[model samples]
Target chain A: MRALLIRDLRLAMRAGGGFGLGLAFFLIVVVLVPFAVGPDTSALAVIAPGILWLGALLSCLLSLDRILALDWEDGSLDLLATSPLPLEAVMGVKAVVHWLTTGVPLVLAAPVLGILLNLPSQGIIWIMLSLGLGTPALSIIGVFGAALTVGFKRGGLLLSLLVMPLYVPTLIFGAEVARRGSQGMAVETPFVMLAGITAGSLALMPIACAAVVRVNLR
Target chain B: MKQETMDTLLSVHELSVARGGLSILCDVSFDLFPGQALVLRGRNGIGKTTLLRCLAGLQPVLNGTIDVGADAIAYASHADGIKSMLSVAENLRFWAQVFGTTDIETALVAFDLVALRDRMAGTLSAGQKRRLSLARLVVSGRPIWALDEPTVSLDQASCLLFAQAVQTHLDAAGAAIIATHIDLGVNGQVLQLDPYAATSNTGVPSGFDEAFL
Candidate 1:
């Protein structure tokens, strides 16, 4: 499992691995928001939490296909299935690596980008926290979507369609937490809900993803 | 019968397999013991790959029983599973680590990949990449190898090298089921799959197109 994680990380860091692509996309989305919505500071601040969460979510979505597509194409997935490692562990490691490469960067970058949207002083940490908690769910769910569509030749659009609906609850609670935090309202409720969704996904998505991968391999 | 069952490493009884929801092979039974290699011979599109997939547990068996120990078999398919970005050595090392083994030197030497160990897999030629992939089986250390057309695009000498590797594997009491056309000169029983071909009458008609018939 450690080897798979290290290999995935190394692969992502390599050229054409799409490692920094999500972060770059996140940056572009944040930068473009000010341009698209005009320079109204208060207006931007009102929507900053939601926009940042959406950007992070979409950026995480963009790379979901990479989780298993390459391995499936080269037949490594089949070999991995037959290896000593359980399919569930393989799926879990993939989600963790995806989170490490894509989710963590987005979380770290959210705070810096939050400044561009005139984010409230208190909202910065909350937005970062929300993203940090929420993006793992995105990665885990994205892996499940990736596995479902790995058998398709052109699965990117299909993957987005399948994963976006699953992201709804996470997005709602995550954005709610950030919005409430920026507004200085009580955030514990939405924050707990967001963490619950993340925890639930972490516990269940790997098994579902592994089963989907097994079917796809078949 | 009792002694044979104890010695059997892999046993398939009345096995039937399908491809794209259509049964292709039926009633295929075989028993593989330690240190045995079973070569599956058939024409193209004859379900050789499908049967191998079934044996490797990559596909569901339509109807059958496959008796083998869990995690006891390693499967290699036509797709080499090589990551072009990684060096040959890195590729082998990754799989070795995956299969919980560490002796890559032996695999490298076995497949003559030591000279190109540091070279990226992408830089290797077709034959070289195939060698690296075959070397993966060596590092796998599993007792059983389920290989699907393992020796394609190889020159005679490389084929000989692969044969020698299989010989060494069998010498160490490992078993292999290889589907190939050419002779690798390995002393193993050949199981021709032509006789087990699923006839149209035996398989249930599937799909809307078949409904009209």
Candidate 2:
């Protein structure tokens, strides 16, 4: 698993369009929301959770296609598939790598991005914590979606369409928790619910990804 | 040659597979014995690769079963199965780690690719890429090796080198199921599938004959 993680990091680093591009994209999203909403701190503060959640979600989507497509094209995926390492373990490793590349970084950057959008100071913590817990589920579920669509030529668009719907519940609860916390409302219940979505997706997504990969291989 | 009994390494019974609402292969069955090699031959569009995939558990047998015995096996295809972004050595190292091996230098030397080890797999020429992929199988240390068109992009020298590797593996009582157009330089049973046999009601022509001797 460590080998797989190190290998993925090396590939992403060498691939040249990595952390910089993701950070730049996140910056654009953060900057653009203020333009779309005018310089109204009232409006931005109210919608801050939605804006942050949506920005992180879109950034997560941007990297999803690479999760398997690169490996599939170069034949590394097939070699990994045939190895004694079970597909579930491979999926687990892949999800962890995806999280490391996209999710954790986005969480660390969310506060700055959130503040830029004139978010409430109290809500900044909620945005960071919710995303920290929530983005992992997105990566895991996105992996399964990516596997299903890896074979199609125009799979990236299709992958987004398919996975976005599956992500709604997580998004809803995640944004809701952040929204409540920003308003100084009760946050534990919604936060727990968001964590449930993450935990449930974590348990289910790898198996689903493995099953989808088997179908795609066939 | 004296008749010597060998333990069955792989057993496939009445295997079938379907795709796009049509059966691609049906009732396909074969046994692989220790130290024995099997050549799967058929024209393009036939189910040769499909059978290999089924045996490797890459594709599901729509019906029936495949029981792979205790021996470890490796499957290589025309895909070369190496990550193009990674250097050849990195690719081999990843596989070695996954297969629980620490030594891959010998495998690299055997395939004559030690010099190209640092080159990105995508940058290697066709023959070099094929050799790198084969080198993986060499270091894998599995007793059963299944290859699909392993010689597709290989040059003459590398082709001969691959044959030697297979010869050595077979000499050590390993088994192989190879799908190829060219010969693998080993005396083995040939199971041929007539591309048209499934369309017509005619019995499949078993391609094994005296020349296989």
Candidate 3:
């Protein structure tokens, strides 16, 4: 499993490193929102949490199609399936790697992006914390989407469509925690819900994603 | 050939397979023993790939039985499974780690990939990619190798390389089931699939939900 993770990381870093694409997209979204919303400091601050969470969510989706589709295309998935490694574990590892490459980078980059959106000094850490807590669910759920559309020739749009609805809870709770913290309101409830969603997905999504991949392979 | 006294490695009894819920092959049975090679021959679209896949447990058997031991089979097909971005050595290293082996050197030598070891897989020619794919089977260290059109892109020289690899594996008491249209240049029993092709009179509906209902 460590080999698979190391190999995937190497691929992500060397192969045009679509790794940067997600973070770049996040930056662009944060920067673009300010221009679109007309440079109002209070206005940017008012919707900053929503915009940041949405940006992170979209950043994840942008790279979701890569998780399993390449392996499936080249038959690495078939070899993995036949190996001693359980399909569930293969997918579980994939989600972890995706989060490491995309989610962790986003969390670290979120605070930096927050500055451009006129986020208050106190709110920046909360944005990072909320993302750090919530993006695992994003990667896990995105694997499910990738598995579902893996056989389709043009799965990018279909993948986004299938994964968008599932991202709702994470987006809602994630934005709420960041927003409430920024406004200096009570943040504990949404924070708990965000963590709960992350934990639930981490436990269940790998099995679900593996099942879908098996059907596609069949 | 000591064929009769050898212990059977795999046995399929009254095995049937379907594709898209439609019966494609029926009443197929074959026995494979250690050091034996079974060549699955058929015209295009004749279910050879499906049969190999079914035996590999990649697809379900519609109405029959297949016996296999745990961790006994390694499957390779037209898809080379080599990552374009990784060098040939990296690709072999990944599979070596996967099959719990540290023998990338043997696989590289067996498949003549040592010269191309440091070259990225994307830059290798089609025949070279096929060689890289077959080399993975060596690291797999499984008893039974199930291959589907494994020689699809090989030239005569590469084909000989593959035949030699299979020869050595069978020499080690391993068995193989090869699904291919061309000759493997290895001595083996041929099981033609056309004789078992599903006829319209089998009376099962094309779709399983309707047929099984």
Interface RMSD of each: 4.3, 7.5, 3.1
Per-residue accuracy of model 1 over A1-218 as CA lDDT, tens digit each: 99999998999999889999899999999999999999999999999999999999989998898889999998889889988899999999999999999999999898889999999999998998999999999999999999999868889999999999999999999999999999999999999999999999999999999888887787
Q: Candidate 1 vs. truth: CA RMSD?
A: 2.9
Candidate 2, DockQ score (0 to 1): 0.38
Candidate 3 regions with alpha-carbon error over 4 angstroms? B1-6, B201-213
Candidate 2's TM-score: 0.90
Model 1 chain B weakest 10-residue run by lDDT: B204-213
**Superposing all C-alpha atoms, what RMSD in Å does each candidate have to the true structure?**
2.9, 6.1, 3.1
Give the TM-score between model 1's chain B and the true chain B.
0.92
Candidate 1 runs further than 4 Å off: B1-4, B201-213
Clashing pairs in 2: none
- In Å, what is the interface RMSD of model 1? 4.3
Q: lDDT per residue, candidate 2, B45-103, as tens digits?
A: 67777777766777655567777754367988668777777999998898888788878
